[model samples]
Target: MPRPTPSPRPRRLGVAAALAVALTLVGGCGTTSSSGNLKVYQQEQFEPGETFSRMFDASVSQTCEAARRALLSQGYIVTVLRPDAINGSKNFQPGGEAHVQITFNIVCTDDGNQGKLSSAYVSATQDRYTLKKSPNSASVGVSAIGSLSIPFASTDDSLVKVASETIPAGVFYDRFFALMASHLKELQMDAAVD
Candidate 1:
């Protein structure tokens, strides 16, 4: 007869023990660490510097035309127009009793490549007006049956422009200049097509 085979229970126990020891030996070779070299950095904000493009390529006249388009796109009414300057205004009613407006004036340097903008200064002013409501009653002379009376309701602005503030030459101007740049590009493209 062949040698008696080992019991299945003992064989299974031996295999399990060997596997646990192997895992322990393999795992013990590596060191666990908590501290890491990872770094956290915040994003840099967009700051308009002194050299920001207030003056750019294109002529004063063409740039003014581009400015007109830009302002119109932004719902501004172009009031005064000149070869080297533009003035526009936008209106807003934030509340039922208040009316606000912003006036935009852009003056471009007149020296450039006939159609290129060399330099420009843009200014924006914010003005607020309030609405007033007053009640008045007027009585006419007695009529045949009853006295004639009229009540008038009116709301009017003081017609005074007040508290105007000029916008700074920072992000607002940067954005305006960027839009003007794009508009100038478009004008060029349009001329090329023509």
Candidate 2:
């Protein structure tokens, strides 16, 4: 027995479907406005500490988080947050007591269609030292002395600069909306075609 042939309408529908798929693929490839698809989220900051060591951690955490949030608002996805220690030292006072100094590390990551884009480790530290005087000393003993140290403190500055320079909201939106308008133009062109 001879098999029934497929209807012409079915064959036309199949061709139309294939053509739609091809057009979509071509459109996606030709369009450079992937910027509109980008998304930015919030930034995170670390905690503060009482002591030098803890303060160092706090500084980095706070700064890095701020940077992360800024980037997120610009559509970058944060992936990591970690601290790096720079140097440790001791400060000696006239009385015979010593203080310790420490620094912190900053790391952040972002996700994109291409891959993960990450910022470099930004470092920040805050150190405090207190000196104690000997009671036996005849001279009026100093009650206490204090000092603080911070390294890589400029991370915040750099982050701010980058954010301002890279993600100007006015400029970004203008370009984004313009690209969208162009896509609409393409759609209109397609619609006008027979």
Candidate 3:
């Protein structure tokens, strides 16, 4: 009788199998924490004409409030304001040109299996401007993703930082707002406001 031949297993196949098994086990191991306790502190609305101090305070307040509401939906315990006062500024031109600047001082602490993790963050001066008003205010859609070092902090802080740092103050007014205006009629017909 002729000798029976055995099937050969490729080296790559063995390595790939091991990698997949390792990834599966690692992915299933750790539990992430819930971000249900963050608090937000809003300053107040800063209009175009006001003392520099008051205007700045209002800007910080508005930004903090907006950030807080957005973050809450994602399950974060955020404190929008610091113990010390923050400063902000907003400028508006006659032809619907507007500029805004906001700064923040933040301190946060959270507990996880690795131990308590705390960080102090200072996000300084996010400025934006708008040139034209939108006909359909609802058309403006702002979204952010933020994340902390904690196991379950799902928010991507990098997005927030990018929005703050890179977006020009008045680009929305010139572009996004204009788009909203052109689409207002259609938007109203299709959507109902509460």
Candidate 4:
């Protein structure tokens, strides 16, 4: 007996089913992550002595002044200086079209003993930028004719901030604190001598 041939309808349906499954998987790939990223705030521990603050044996004004000098010595531009607070920033161009800016903010508070003991709390933020180029557009209108729009072939380049974050506590903070301490010690010695 001769064998019968398979029907064309079933073969076509099989191909269609396979294609649908493949498309469903490919579509899922382009989907974005969930909106639960905002929950990252829950990760903050706010632990003490981790990296953002330290104590100094001086008045609030003295501690702030020492921080200012330490920043200036390292080529930071001091933007705000006060008895209890200081703000400074420095720019860096490591290489290529990348640029970095580090801004330091310091707050000094009297620990106790009529300003004889003080504490310094510092935080540094790093902002990263990259060069970006955008195309320019030109438009001209003539009374004799209709309005004309032209796209300029030239590119306009600018720096765009890409990322910003507060520097975590580590050797970077350690070095800064060490420098500030040295400056504070110098100030104390000068006062003692005078």
Candidate 5:
């Protein structure tokens, strides 16, 4: 009995088969799935003129009044009012032990726009506070068949300052400018009537 020898053609075909499989695997590795949503995020940019160049062609008193009216409309408590400046603040209690507040300070410059232009400098300060609970004792005593004194269940809560930041100029000022514009128009109408 004699063993049959392998043919050279078959060996070549086997090599070709292995090479084909290797090529297929390598080709599949370079492909990626095309079924995903992609999004690009860019930082917000604010123009300097848009942020601070809001000018109302009205008198200082009229412009300040407009700012006051605008602040009042947006639930701001007007704390300080002057001929050239307005200050307002609002408080928010979001949840337990958390308190947040934003204060708006607007300074108007009367640079003699022929008494026609008043420019408001807008800025805001954001403050956050947390409530601190402290236990206090009241006079505790017991009087039989008479008034009985008990420990106070009421806890005193004081606000502890946590953080504060100055808001930068941006579209956050657009509303203020819009409000001032509306008020300026009304003021002009009033002056025209007088």
Candidate 6:
């Protein structure tokens, strides 16, 4: 007599249980949850002139001009220049084959006091890059073998961006505002003398 065959249902359930546990453990290894991270946006208080902005007692054009001069004084390459907006970028090497770039964006607008009062809003972003090398590969055709692919010892190097963050409002912005104020003052003095 042939023995009764065991049911496949039990074996299937065991496999399903093992798969569920393995998936759970693998999911927990992630640095962030599936819900993602929004702490940066949530932390913003949006207080007026707290960090990213300052008010100036001048016209919008004058304020933007001052911002331009301030960025140029710091050796930043001005990329965009306008009467009400200015953008500049500067590069820095902090060693270890790492590169950093800081880009400044400024916008000037009237402060509801006709053309006498204006506000200059500034925001800066810092981008960090690292050198990445990829090995060079060559594919050779041989009569015996269909094709053979080989990697050479030589590598191609490139800058790969790693991290980017907005510069928080602090001493960095404070010093910028101070310098801009001095430049504006000088411009006013020059105008008065003329």
Give each model's whole-structure lDDT.
Answer: 0.75, 0.38, 0.36, 0.89, 0.82, 0.91
Q: Best-fitting candidate, measured by TM-score?
A: 6
Off by over 4 Å in 3: 1-96, 108-119, 133-163, 166-194
Q: How far out, in Å, is residue 141 in model 4?
A: 15
- Our model 2 lands, by Cα RMSD against the true structure, at 29.4
Per-residue accuracy of model 4 over 138-180 as CA lDDT, tens digit each: 8899899978988998989899999999998989988988999
lDDT, residue 43, candidate 2: 26
What TM-score quantifies how close candidate 5 is to the native fold?
0.65
Range of the 10 consecutive residues with the lowest summed lDDT in candidate 6:
30-39
- Compute each candidate's TM-score over C-alphas: 0.63, 0.20, 0.19, 0.71, 0.65, 0.72
What local lDDT does model 5 show for residue 84? 91
Candidate with more favorable, higher lDDT: 5 or 6: 6
Name the regions of candidate 5 deviating beyond 4 angstroms: 1-53, 138-152
TM-score: which is higher, 1 or 4? 4
Please report the candidate that would top lDDT against the real structure: 6
Question: Best to worst by lDDT, what's the order?
Answer: 6, 4, 5, 1, 2, 3
Clashing residue pairs in all predictions, respectively, total: 7, 10, 18, 0, 0, 0
- Extract clashing residue pairs from model 1: 57-117, 58-115, 58-116, 58-117, 59-115, 59-116, 59-117
Candidate 3 lDDT tens digits, 1-194:
99977556667788999999998776654332244332222223355432121111122323233334333443444444443332233332333344444443332332232422222222334545454332321233345544333234233322112224423234432342233233433333444562
Please give the lDDT score at residue 67 for candidate 2. 44
Q: Score candidate 4 by lDDT.
A: 0.89
| Model 2 weakest 10-residue run by lDDT | 157-166
User: Which one wins by TM-score: 2 or 5?
Assistant: 5
